[model samples]
Target: MFSLLRSATAFLIATASLAQGYSNPGACSGACWAHDPSIIQRTSDNLYFKFNTGSGIEIATASSLSGPWTLTGYALPSGSKIDLAGNTDLWAPDVHKVGDLYYMYYAVSTSGSQTSAIGLATSSTMDVGSWTDLGATGVASSPSKVYNAIDPNLIAVGSSYYLNFGSFWHDIYQVQMSSDAKTPSGTSVNIEYDATGTHPCEGSYMFYYSGYYYLLWSHGICCGYDTTKPATGDEYKIMMCRSTSATGGFVDQSGVACTSSGGTTLLASHGTTYGPGVFTDSSKGLVLYYHYADTDVGLGDGSYLFGWNVLGWSNGWPTV
Candidate 1:
């Protein structure tokens, strides 16, 4: 009986360990229409701010990660000034703070074209009316260009800053940025790609943890809003790779290079939520903010809600 009790206790502990993962804290309220959300917490007031893709760039604020968020305003009311792409709706904003000012890198493009540009804006405060558009970051695309320049993310390593951006055509690319964080100071390098068919990787976000640079990205089709979903059920899952160096040579758990279409699945569509954005909160630590089509709310009815889960790490990999 003593041996049996010990075995049962061990089994229970193992089951609990395996069950550790992401959990949605609660429902958010007020102006929660968010997609590809990038969040930052203000150091002065401790208020949480979210920047998302929308008409210009949607800004929302809340006292906590889970809360009654209120729509503050748009980053650009007049729209971008990038030739044909300007004045159109912006997509996939990445926000970072340098010194005292906040720098927001946003994408400008037509609905389905490689002719796109990544623009920058800065503000002392993240308030909607305070932003000053700094124009294009010298990352632009023509019809002849192989990589689409959208979904921009900024990472600062030591004193150098690098910008990672790209979509469908060649997956994700990285380039060193000038000190101002606006213009590219070096040639762009292809960091992540998919050899499996149409190359469905985008939204590249790099997080530095425990001496490893974890490159997290969304794979497969996304942004169906309501009417559409990935044809393959497994297409729109969050995938990840890691490396000691931030610039290149990211690999999966099995030692396959990310440039060769290797990635470890982090999160997949379970229940309703899909297409998670890698985020970090002060209290919640690492979080995955995603959009979900509520089944009870029905599909194609335009009810995509924001969902989030605080991530747990095991063996240097994030699980959610």
Candidate 2:
């Protein structure tokens, strides 16, 4: 166990050193947002594109893993078509860059409901204003629920594209996408099941880390409201689990098996940080995007603003 831990640690540190030289991740005030961020490493220009769902899913380009990031504003523009739940469709977007084209997978619906489905959009720029939506996702097996089949994320492993998505109702499902890059093919697998159904899990960001496919997600409540102190189980937190395959049977490095009932906690609210996004900064390696609520020292109300932490792997798992 110790040897495994050491090996993972060294790999992370070495990668950071080689991918180092950046000022680091984190920024001052006003860099905040209702963050459900996803990052894409544009190897072409050596730039890391950071994007998120809330605060209207804007694009920001950073040369270094750290600051000096330039904001490109809302990618979808103000007049983009929204389904029904107001403009809440732009939530938890997964972004990828093919060649020079940046593609974003996002959820679209009038209100947050099972009627919600995934939409695909492509842009020559990270600007959503220039993105072209591929239209509605037909993978929703059940047509009753309006907002359930949203939150689309795609991973290109080898030559295959695997798409994963789900909502707060149940487990997330994975379906293979055709190489055409727009449609789903093959069998759909319901890999990660949230058995508890306790409203603590959703948004599974699966990434390959440390020779394992790590599923990082935010658990508990998200986007704080000025409430009367949330109960212990109700506060938002970041958790993770790993599997040899993108599908399932993931366990934390501690051998603590992660199920819907109990999973490994990565980053919990340190008085304010909540609902995080994890990605590898091509310029700086692993990075954690989160929101911080300085309730005790906030900008008035006890809500969260966008915050980030540079990630370092310790003991074969990610550490903040």
Candidate 3:
């Protein structure tokens, strides 16, 4: 009995260490089907809105972070002008409000191919018919391109703005944006890359907390739903790095550069949850929202529920 107790204690300690600083808050119900979700809180009425990858870029609204979310409508019902590449299915959206207008950056790609383009759309109000598609941002990927132009995220630091994007081929890249937040101005710079794996990292979201710019991204195979999962047990994990400057010099906890294959695992396949997207929740502080295959809800049927957790800070790093 004593030996068994010691073994169990050791197992618990190991599990705790693997979790890092995050804890699963619970599953979100009612219109929770979301992948590559980007969240923003509207200041007009303080309502929370989440945009996701889907046919027309799915939109979900809630009053609070702990949501009784409802799928109201899609940002683009008629699909984007670049509908040939994205078809009706778009991927990985990043939404941010600039001044009185809201800007949404989304990925348009031909399924598995790297032929992709990042497009811009704007809305005065985040309603269904309010959004106006501004066409592509001139950032695109071709067969000869080394970087995949998808998963666009706009990071605003002070007066300057940067659009961070890329996937698969070379991972993440960033470029300084015009004041309008729609056009890329300066030269695009490589931000993060993993020299190993099929698709090392994607879905880059940069958050400025305390004095550091924390770069959070998803690593490993994503979007198998329930039909497939990562055999290496590394799929859809949230990886993180930090730097004082928003542009470059990001490093993991071990002081390893992000330009290398260095990233500290922030969240991984804990139980059924996977594919975490970190965002700031106005009411709940820092929140990590992801998708999970709930065994209780029938696993292999592609019924991945929404999963979320409030992140805590320890030693200037984010914890769940």
Q: Please, what's the RMSD in Å of model 2?
A: 7.5
lDDT of the candidates, in the order given: 0.72, 0.57, 0.71
**lDDT, candidate 2, 1-320, per-residue tens:** 00001000000100112132322226643343334566666655766566756535677766664556668777766523545453543766677765567777776654335666677778886654677766555555345642256667776766777777775666566788888567788766665555664544567677776578776655665543344445654656666778888766777666665554446776654433322366555544566665445544442223444455667777788777
Pairs that clash in candidate 3: 21-319, 21-320, 22-320, 23-320
The TM-score values for the models, in the order shown, are 0.89, 0.78, 0.89
lDDT of model number 2: 0.57
TM-score of 1: 0.89
| Candidate 1 lDDT, 134-249, residue by residue in tens | 87889987779879898888888888888888888988899999987779999999999998878877778887778998887777766553455456443356778999999998
lDDT of 1 at 272: 38
Give every collision pair in model 1.
none
In model 2, the worst 10-residue window by lDDT is 2-11
TM-score, cand. 2 vs. native: 0.78
Error of 1 at 192 (Å): 0.5
